[model samples]
Target: KEGRKLEQTARLIQKTAEAKNMPATKRAALNMQKLGRRMAQGRMDKKQAMVRMAQLTKQMQAQQRQLAQQAGQAALGGGKSLSQAGQQLAAALQSQAAGGQNAQGASKMQGAHSAGSKSTGEKSGANGGNKPAGQNAGHGFNVPGRNKPGDKPPQNALHGAAQPTPEMKQIAQALQQNNAQTLSEQLRQLARKAETGQMTPQQQQQAAQDLQKLADALQGTGMPETQQHAQAAAQAMAHGDKQTAAAEMRKAADAAEREAQQQQDAQGMQDAQNSLQDSQGEMAGAQDPGDIPDGPSGQGQGQKPGGKGQGQTGPPEYGGEGNGGRGGGRGKPNTTYHKGQKPSHKIRQKPGYGADAPHWLDPHFDPAKNPRYAKLYFGKPRTAGPSQAGPTRKTRPGEDTGPVRSTVPYYNSVVSARKTAENAMDREDIPPAYKKNVADYFNSLQPQSPPPPASSGAGGTKP
Candidate 1:
């Protein structure tokens, strides 16, 4: 029983190495390698090895299903094929297996295995031989054109595989049927799934790309509503607002349905035209009358029937018979004041005629044109008084006045001299004499009157 179990494990490993499902085959190959190590190291007995092998078999089976599903998804998503993925996985597994043994021996074995596998794959492709063990090459399912069990994956096939989603399947079906309404509905559901964060980012991106393709197809078929929904879905995915995109898709579906119904009903078409005409008439009527220009005779074109100046009687022109004078229908003159009433005689000069007029007020006044007045008017104006009046006498600091009089000039002069002396003293280079002069000047500026004597008492005056 132990020998039989060992043989079975070897067979399973060989079959896994040849499997067409790349992910599953790789997983199985890895487990087989680990099992071989355990057996060689004497770590697992017969019963234990059998149990582990059974576990591995079950795991491989599940993985196979997963890998198949992934391949289908890849085809639907417009990516790599199942056979290409499997070939890549086989190569990786062989490399791993080779690394486990003695270097020289492993290299020899790996070369043999690669050559044999290549020949076998070629034979199957050219002669239509029986499908290899543990491979799904000859299955009846529809696959991408380039996909075949023995075919190698593209150089850029290193990216992880994407699993199929319900939304993706529905979209594929809708596309196959070429039904715009159905496609719109499926896209809406996909957008909703993306909005709820149920789908992975990669899946969302793929869905968005597919939607764009569908939109293009629909656009070519004269289904703008459906195309719009798909475009909106793509945009929503880009902005991460899947819910809004879904809503837009739903609206597109509804619009398509409505359009179909409208095509089938002739009365609906007539009603729509009538409604459009009514709306246009209302818009024209709502326009402001003042916006329209009056004709030469002061009558506006396109005016309503009952508007002013239509048929109502009014005063005739100057030559009509109603009035005696040339003026039509004589009435009180339209004047604020009587003919003899004159305004005030206060003559006012024009704006630019004043002496204080700004230079810019005279358009012809350019400094370059007339340089004579440039210094007088364009440059700073002359001071109001003479530039240099009589020389101001400089009095000596701290000089005493003859008397103290309660007059403005006397007080002003004294205050001014004191301030001048104080300012001179503040200068760093001034001598101490200047400070002394300021102090003396301040004392002289004080009033000369003595203080009044205090009263003897409140009730007994001089007594």
Candidate 2:
């Protein structure tokens, strides 16, 4: 039976070999080698546990060492350098393109970040959906005479390739439908329009760029006219540059600088106001003069030199206190005895001389003029009325009058005088003997004249 089994196995193996290619058996041998390798690595519970424990211990030690180093660095108080990410963020904010502000500030933070503005690149990243300034060239986006994909004419393209733009298809269709006459008429219209200067400045720029793109697109699209038009447009656009862009930028910068300068001036004015407020406060706290501190100096203001306080009282002024002028209360003038107190004896009536002015009013009217009449007037009083002659007097005619004043003495009173004279002599007015001698002598002198001479003078007058 064994022999029969072996023969069957050999027969089955031969049949399998005949049905397949020889390479399939080589692959079978490779598969048998792979199965032997898989069976050789058997699972072991105890040995695997020991290896896992060792690995766990080693990993724990390494982690502990790393933690210890970190702790030591923290305790040493070392300042840390900024991370690469933070540094890059700061650098981006400080870039030249970001003239006004830096990167982080583009988001508009408060406090420290608010002080510096954000960069242009950062702003572009922030608001690129809008027309950001960073990517703008002087003119239109596409350069002149440049090829544009998906913008070529369909007729000029390879078969089964992308279709052409609407403008390109329109132009191509027009060209296909035109003869020389129609094309010439269209060309003439275009020439007239160009000569009339129909385009605005912006439209001209866009048109030039579009023509260049069309020329490049038509080069392989079987259109020679488009190529010429593109070349002309590109050259004209190149020469049309006037540096207007740079002048606009400079003008903007100058305006910004002026605004900043005005801000600084406003800040300076505010500071000056603050300083003035401080000075006012100082003055407000100051004490008045004469309210001096300890030794007669005003508080804070100090003492003036020579026993005076700064801003102190002035000198005792005239016409003040006890020194009032005329009509002053309780202050009197010196007593002076004036001359007009006495009366005068002499009087003259004249116009406007009411009582006469005063004794002191006139220069000559002095009470002390004469020492004796110091209290009296110098002249007599005036008569009350006109003068009258006394009663008329009669004289005896031719009565032996020699000189009217004195030829002989009057005798009628002589006897009466003799008696009185004798009596006055008897009273010793003259001594008695001297009086008798005077009488005897006068009686003797009366008898001594020449009587013949008197007779002779009378006889001559009679003859």
Candidate 3:
């Protein structure tokens, strides 16, 4: 069993070594494609495209250089697959980068020519030549091999600006298939249609196909209920029942989330299991080897593998807490027990057993009176941190404390409270008298000005 385990470990190590460059290489290729898509869609302008293309090309070159080291390592591990894939992807990226630069330059030149043409036409019109370009250019204006405003550009137009390389497309396709993001997006679109109460026959048919694919992808993940819901949704879509389809798709989405969480937990459990198995194998191998036969040299067959010393004759020292051996002292044996009962050890006492805790542990205990605890048990007070410090109020021993001024402005605090009380008062279950009192209290709390005095006598001469 140990030999078999060692063989498996060796194979896993080799596999890991061969795939060391896979993730970064794949990422570089996919980023190149995403940048191309952005440029083609006009989301990225010319200067930005040039800078990004240059950076991506540089990254690909660096990744290629790293591939050399990876290749050497993989060769020592007996494989060159990673190096080969990296080389191919790097070459593709370089070629694609060159093509993108050329296309961008061409587009820039075309834009310059168009600007020149417009300027020349404007000058000619000013000088009494033919009407300037774009005159009467609106609805119903057509020019051969050209698209008007608000018209969808031809597919060739996108290709002319920036085209994705074959390697990038393959990487993107593989990513999309592996991830559930596309599945979730499709379900969202179907849900939108259902919400709008508008699902055409063609759309319904397409949704059915998407749901079927989702069902197939979810197979054997211990989520048969999700699969069933997905299939039922697909069937309902085919029958043109948007409501039923939407409900089923919702169930499928919830199940998929749960399944994802379960998969994550299962992966963690698998890692722990592998660790436990490794430890168990190590312990088993370290066991007594005295019974095995000796070789012709008359040497004892009790030594550990890898030319180590003789097998451990005593208990192995596992550096864990509690019980037995030199690394950990043997715990006290079980002694206290009722009559006619088997003695057993207890790591903890019953619930009420520790009610009379030590004096130092009491919640109300003051460390200030105990010099030992005051210096050792208590930590020094921390200085004020980022929060603002407020003024500390001091008063004589018999002075009465007045209402403290609020930190917040009265208007800022009272408005929300009054609004809440008003809303609560609107409830019919409360007595009208209580509501009147609450309203009067809030009204009186409002800020008021002192009444004018002695104005009437000064304004009038003698009445």
Candidate 4:
């Protein structure tokens, strides 16, 4: 009986130790391994591990309590085996938790409890040097390049470069946006070269430059983000200076500026963007119905860049008839003209110019097949004044008819191009001077038309 009692006591003590031991479940072991590795990497120290372990222990205690309650209920009902096991497990955990064991302690125990076996933490913290410059003793607190030392994070962004601030993100965004458009073409070119199995050094250099510019811009914006980036760059350069030495230097300098507190990230002295946006709104609200737009800015609309006139091509009905005035027409000033008349295919050739009159007329104007002006003249062939009122042909021969008649279709074509171009350019908030040039170019293309047809034998003979 005495021997049995001693055995029982030993068993009880062993069980208690087991409970306190906090079984290294696969998850627990993994966590321990991770902590050990981090410590060895010089990324963390004993204190950091302790903090983490403490956090984990709290979670385990909560789970243990719930299990105990379930087991207690079972035991009360006479279903004792499973309940017994739960009770034992609960008691074990309670003892450890009561002893104030923390996650950090548990993690350290994993290292101390095992030996002769290699471990991540031991391997990493191998130098046995405490507090290496760049590495945190525990919990990944190291700045970049401790053996090399990274710059401290921007003070404004965090207490001491610990967390990213909103300003930092904005700076990053600006950095990316500034370079995005310009390098789009270059990116495409590189992609093409890769597909074709070759890349040029120049292309590679340009690509690196583009990326450097963006990274620097973000860092220099006085954002906490700069610290993270700065660290990364330092690490990259630590290896016998870096591969992209020149490029990295540029990026670092750029970031240095961003990290400066005096450089306001937003609302800088040179910011002209807001004024530009207001200008755009004014332009949107101020679009004219009569102008036919043209330019790289005007797509689908048949106008030229700089608001220069392009002769109408194809059928006139493809586009609505030329705007007669500001409110009614698409490309020109809306006026009393075409008010009563329904929109039609009439091409207003040159206006107010008699048939066959001057050399200054549009050189591209074709009488037989110019679709834009054909309708205006065709609609009212006899509209020209009578011969007594005026000669059909102003010149005897070889002289031009000033310009072609103002045909509804052709006039409307001009209006379409002008309007579309104007809308696009205006939206972009281009300078007023540039916009004016666009407007003036269109106005110059208005075709001169003939007077009412002559009544008797005029110089012109009609088929």
Candidate 5:
């Protein structure tokens, strides 16, 4: 009966020791405590109790070894499994503590626990050290374990000392081609890679240079807002501010798109204007001069047939009879006069000369009839009339105060040129200093009001 009872107690202790919820070491400790109680109660002999305690201790040690093996496997996998491995190691140590029976056993358990802890620490360090600098810093905490004693610290990719990469060269070429959209996209990608610690130091530096080049190209495009954004993005990249750089790159792309649209619109307008001008010129050239109406002077109208002097076909001679007369008549009639015969009508002197003219003004000395007179008075005199009281100022032909004709098309052309220049000056991409000069040039071209016609004084005298 005692043997059967002892067997039942040993089986119960084993079952309790292996409970999943309770740690193996705790179970072993409980088992030892229970065995001591059984011995004190005289329910078991010391030899049998010792034997059962030894078996429990071996079982706990075996469970601990299994946990250590699992930890080693987790560590080798290089994942969150590593943390799991650490938890398992802790569990194994506790299990060892529970199974310890004597001082020697306690010492062995401590040594095993230390070994398990050391292995977990080394696995964690290895995992941290292998990660990229960007990834390591991304979590907001700098783990000192990332830097092993024999490992060199990772360098920043965007440091000034890094050299350009082949990708950077390609990006620069794209910039030179004025491919703002493409360059902006490329820059964004590079910045993202940089943020994720995927770029090498050289590649990061190259990306920064490429961004600067793109900014310069945008500046050339003459879009101020876009250029400003591009420059900001470049500066951000240089400072390793990938987030800012990415945002600025997007802005630059938008600005570039707007500028391109504006250019297209301007080009379309220019083409339409050119086409209209060309069509108008063609229409004007197609018209015949013979189709025009005769002037109010009856000049260029066909002569009347069968009229008194209609058949005269010879070219008219200069200074001929009635050739240069001001009266609106075709030709003067020829008349034969006898000597001493009274003229039918009194002969009037030429319009400009006076009857009391000097002796040099012979009766036949008509300015229209004489080449010398015509040469002497090459142009009409400004002082020809008596009421012309101003000094005889020599004037060029066509200087008379005739009605001025307005050249609307010519004015429009000038205005268009000035407007184009002004628009260029208003562009953000243009240098501020150069913009002032551009504005000045266009302003100078604009027609200014004639200086308020110099205000007249009260007495009508010039101020």
Candidate 6:
């Protein structure tokens, strides 16, 4: 369990690394408050203020674009699993004639499809056969990777990375608009004019109006009240009301700081930091013992210098008699040969005879001693349960009403099977009547649409 926790923590670290660099964005948000304060105090020159404004806008726009791109990729990845589901369903339906194999294949496919759907919804991607990355965010806690029945799961470093929040796409769309981009350009132009001492009164008024528009764009970012004060400050500037503008800007700056603190509190950022610190302290004081023997081949307290002196430390072909010796016993096959030397004779064994052989070349083996040898089963030994003292009692009245139990067929399978049958109907080898019957069967299995509401004059029920 400790090892598992370490693995999960490592995956969580990788996931956090893959997440958008929110710290940079958050710092930029906080810096806006500082910028507002400098403006309110008249501490910075107009040219310097404008340059800083332009830089901050560009930084925010870049971050928004990156978030938008990530969200888009995750959304596109979701549809991919549905396509894979269709393929699995089609293959299962087509293999119905294969008896038990078909049943087993269908059952496994259905399980994987359901698991994948759940993983997609929860953004955990714990299912093994799931495609790599972008379909989900964080890994499920202690959930083992689930591959197909007989297949190995594909490895991915970023598999733990979850989908971006919906707010990311919304915020990006608002901040990356033409007006936001134009506002940045306008700031740069205003800065250049102020630097050259060519800034006109009308131009200053226009810059204030542009700033208000930028603040309006920011209103979509869940800080409407805070940004509203920024808009008021901009309006005051446009009317040549420096005192009111300064006061409003100062208020806006304070509001932004409060908002940031509230956000950190609500998200439990401080708690997470504290927990991480505690974990680090514990890890720092821990140490591993070096004296324990690792395995049979390890050095400490062993039978010999090379341990048990298995074939691992012996000649490939001719080894001393002991457990795991290449001469006999349970060692690996003798594959090493001199450059020009070959065995004088070849040894052959019947099919499955090698299953009990220590080395494939040795066919004279005892199956009774081989743990992996195929065994015949008579039947399962039955054990009797406790006998009741009296006659069987009828189930209680409420027992039957506990819950409805039924096997609900998946809609994707129905759709896929119908599609496959339709394709088969187009083939010339199949009879038209048979094709029609198959089509009718699949069509009946689909969910039916509800009937439309009756019109006022068409026998509609009175409210």
lDDT of 5 by residue, 120-239 (tens): 657767776666656643232334556556655444322222234444444455544545456456655665676777865445545665566545544423355666886887788788
Any idea what lDDT model 6 has? 0.38
Clash list (residue pairs), candidate 1: none
Model 3 clash pairs are none
| lDDT, residue 311, model 2 | 17
State in Å the error of residue 181, model 2: 66
Clash number for each model: 0, 8, 0, 91, 3, 4
Better structure of 3 and 4 per lDDT: 3
Candidate maximizing TM-score: 5
Error of model 2, residue 132, in angstroms:
29
Q: Write the per-residue lDDT of candidate 1 for residues 252-288, one digit (tens) a residue.
A: 6675454323222222222222332333344345532
Instruction: Residues 1-463, candidate 4: write the lDDT tens digits.
Output: 2222222333443343344342322233334345445544657533564565455455444543443343232212222232232233234334433443354355455535443344644554455334544334333233222232344522221112222222222333433443322222332333344335352332233333333333433332223333344444434433323344334434444543432211221211112222223323443465333232212111111222223232222121122222111111133311112124333222222222111111232433333445443332222122222121111222222334454443244443666777786785667433332355456556655534534576667676642
- Name the runs in model 5 displaced over 4 angstroms: 1-162, 165-168, 194-197, 200-206, 289-463
Q: What is the lDDT of residue 229 in candidate 2?
A: 48
How many clashing residue pairs are found in candidate 1? 0
Note each model's CA RMSD in angstroms.
38.2, 58.0, 39.6, 34.8, 45.1, 45.0
| Candidate 6 lDDT tens digits, 2-35 | 2233334434443443353335334443555466
Q: What is candidate 5's CA lDDT for residue 210? A: 55
TM-score of each: 0.23, 0.16, 0.26, 0.17, 0.29, 0.20
Model 3, span 78-112: residue lDDT tens = 23232233344345444555775676566556546
TM match of model 6 to true structure: 0.20
Off by over 4 Å in 2: 1-242, 293-463
- In order, candidate lDDTs are 0.40, 0.30, 0.42, 0.34, 0.42, 0.38
Clashing pairs in 5: 25-98, 224-428, 224-429
Of 3 and 5, the candidate ahead on TM-score is: 5
Candidate 2 lDDT, 305-394, residue by residue in tens: 222111111111101111111111111111212233222222221111111112322333332443332212212222222321111111
